[model samples]
Target: MASKYRRGFDITRDSLRVFTREPSLLLLPALSFLAVGSAFAVLAAILFQQGLVESVVTNDLYKYGALFCAIAISSSVATFFNAAVVHCAAQLFEGNSTSVRDGLAAAWRARRQIAVWAVVAATLGTVLYILDEKFGVVGSLTRAVFNLAWALLTYFIVPVIVLDQRRKLRDQLRRSGSLFRETWGESVSATLGVSFIFLLVALPGVALGVAGYFILDGVLAVGALVGGGGIVVTAIVGSQTASAIVRTALYRYATTGEQVGPFDGRDPDTVFPEN
Candidate 1:
């Protein structure tokens, strides 16, 4: 029997479905740990920069704007890695009992596509940031328009990354854009739904930090750090998971019912060796 929820969303691969089927249950703890580790690294690096981060935050708003370019590049890399983890979890969900190393290996196997796509995404983001920062004309509106556009148009990326072994990254992007046109409404809604839920969680954490600053300075500060970090990482991971989920749906939809594209003779599974 096909599970009713099966039609709702899938993790990018069958394996990811196992993990993200209960996203908050399995994802939050690991995401928090990873976020904590990454945050400490970032904080330490900033602190060692001779107060560069703090100074920029306080004094130069314009230069601080440039940080988005850096963030955009970093986010591209982070997205690629996020796919890796989601796939690993999906494999386990599929009862494969796969290891995380396999996930990393799968990513390395597709490094060329990964690198090229990341560069593309990062460049687009950096360009947007530059235009916004430098001109301030048609900046926020333009960026927001593109943001909403890209949000809907790029659903095929993950499926292309995992399934279409023959298609290059650029080709897959084109193919997916056209393919998902039929379900464009769901695509937009899902992305916006996740974004709204994220803001709901995040805004409260920020408010708590501000309110607690006076009463319980140290504890609240720590709370803010942990909560803020968790929210950020969860949002990041949630996005990849959602992508994986939708990609899985599309893959199954294509294979079983639709004659949308030729079978690339791929299993759509990430294989790894025993560790």
Candidate 2:
């Protein structure tokens, strides 16, 4: 049963294969989300520099409440889109020959449900923020609970909206929670498997990005001025690209039960040779 989240898809072989098959294709959906999410991140940075964050923090009795909420909401939207794209990418990664148009259309089809999920998530996130502010809990404690819930909820929305293709928003969200309990172990492994891949990519990318930026600075005085923004953006895109690929792999491994060993799958849209 699609709802039997316990028979979790095998991420070891198939997950990596998806990214290997179409390295370039993996980045599109994530980039789409990044385009929106990163814009907010950039805007937040600008506002912080302008003392907007400081002023808000100082004036409000619940200084960090709004800040936390905004960040949570932004991250929620980003993750939702990422999940949707992961579904689309999984289809393509499995040799489905689907166009980005079809992939995106599939996601768009579930936009209302996703939007609803995001709203629910945002509300819960805000409530948690309020609780933290009121209680003055440690930051680490707050983060662990928040991220764990987010991780658990990860496959719920994707499975409900994209794979299940349900029309009603409530049905999707409701089904997701139910689905999580069915195969809790497998569902979690799949997420962790993919998350590990993204983390693997992050380490090298950070080193390269930072090293590259400084190298450019050494050669060209005012390198940060001439190309700082572009370099930062490139680093971000690079990390997003890697993260997206791993996510696409996880989706395939989960949905299709296909194992994608390193370099073992067909390139996206590739024509197979006749035996």
| Per-model TM-score versus the true fold | 0.64, 0.62
For candidate 1, lDDT tens digit of each residue in 1-275?
Answer: 13312222222233233554344434433543465467557755865676666565665453444454455445555555655654564454355765556666765677777767766776678677667767687887788889778756667665557556434766877766775775455455434444455455567656655655655667667787677666666655555555455455445444453311111232222111111
- Model 2 lDDT per residue over 1-275, tens place: 33222212223335434545456555554555566667677767877887777766676644555555565566556655565456655565566655456656667776777677666666666666666666666754785688687666554566556777777766765666666665465455444444454454445545555655666555553444345444445444444443454444433444455544321353321211121
What would the TM-score be for candidate 1 when compared with the true structure? 0.64
- Highest TM-score: which candidate? 1
Candidate 2 accuracy as lDDT: 0.54
Q: Which residue pairs show collisions in model 2? A: 5-183, 6-183, 13-259, 13-260, 13-261, 14-259, 14-260, 17-260
Cα distance off (Å), candidate 1, residue 55: 11
Worst 10 residues of 1 by lDDT: 266-275
Scored by CA lDDT, what does every candidate get? 0.54, 0.54
